[model samples]
Target: MKIQIEKEKLQAAYKNACGCVKDAFEKLFGEDVLETAKPTLDDYKTIKSYEDACDVLGLSPILSENRNKALCAQFPDHYDFRQNMPKHIIALMKLEIISRALWGKSFEPEPDAEGNKIYWYPWFALYTKDEVDRMSDEERKSLCGALFGGAGHGAYAGFGYLTADGRSSDSGADIGIRLCQETEEKAAYFGRQFIELWAEYLAYGFKVTEHLK
Candidate 1:
């Protein structure tokens, strides 16, 4: 059977999902959870001035500049100014969070031949197949939580802090929040109570109640 989710219900679901993630994050990292990473504008200034912000901050100044130019060329006003800047800012913040969480964590290379460490982005590559194979199930769960939880925080921050028109932080936040909620679900599936609830309340099915006018 199909289930319909009204606007209020959807909002409630979103809130519940966010709460689950926040709770899990607190349990893992302790009381000062969101404070684990704070964003800085130094990278923004550097990128605006055409410096190598990418090396330290995982942001490509050249790409960002090109994006700005393209956006200006297309939207020319508040559209460009409001949208891209917030997304980039949030991306940098997320990178910082990931970097801090991953520091000193053991992540080996692939192929058992190349000794190079894995690159942090794309998230899936956080652990190689071999590395995962070597880990106990509990260890694997912790790694999964670290990866998803950290990313979820970044996405959550983006959603909470950034405001933009189309393709706003909601996109990333939805993915991050869902992944985080799934962590709890996976724990439950394994007969553990790592988290109290599903990140999302509407996991079964939900249909839009109305279209935005």
Candidate 2:
């Protein structure tokens, strides 16, 4: 089956999600909160790496506190700043992971050993189309649910490691679903949407839920 993505529709949905995040942030933290908390490039240069920036800037306390509060609102897990991972960095990680999983088809990654550069495939590309078609309705639903993972749910999905050959050696590997050549337009779309999605995630502390709004 030929895969087709509605780029215009996706753009609109991404814009709407941005708006939702903007509104939520403005309502909860005031309009200028981000500007107030903005970190400068000089500030970044003072730290050894992005992961350690929060520790140097004393942001670890507030960010980790808020994150743990958010997590506690949903789960019983209690998180601390001992690991040097800040909320903003974690937010960036979440955005990058979700965008790569969902919008990766828009760009072409480096080719694998077989000289195949599968662009624009879902993370769960392990199953063939025929295999997917053979599954019962209930099974398909469950599979899709698992593939989507904790994208919009209460938790965030963890990383899926790839081996040297770019194949899944572990359980949650990112074997792409769709394969196609990347275009300039698609690359631009991915770049723009990536920034928007990252900003939205930072502002609202949630995954995008309005895809077609």
lDDT for position 163 in model 2: 47
RMSD versus native structure for model 1: 20.8
List per-candidate RMSD values in Å.
20.8, 21.0
In candidate 2, how many Å is residue 52 off? 26
Model 2 C-alpha lDDT per residue in residues 74-150, reported as the tens digit of each score? 44554555336654565555434433333322342553544343344212124668778999999999988876675
lDDT of 1: 0.35
Can you write out model 1's per-residue Cα lDDT over 1-213, one digit (the tens) per residue?
976556433433333456677567556545542342232333221221112223434443333334555445544543323235544454444333333322213322222123232222222133457768999999999878866675534433122233454432233334332122112322222111111112112121222222200
Model 2 segments more than 4 A misplaced: 1-65, 68-71, 80-83, 86-92, 103-108, 112-189, 194-213
Q: List the residue pairs that clash in candidate 1.
A: 17-199
* Model 1 residue 14 distance off true place after TM-score fit, in angstroms: 52
Q: What's the distance in Å from true for residue 107, model 1? A: 36
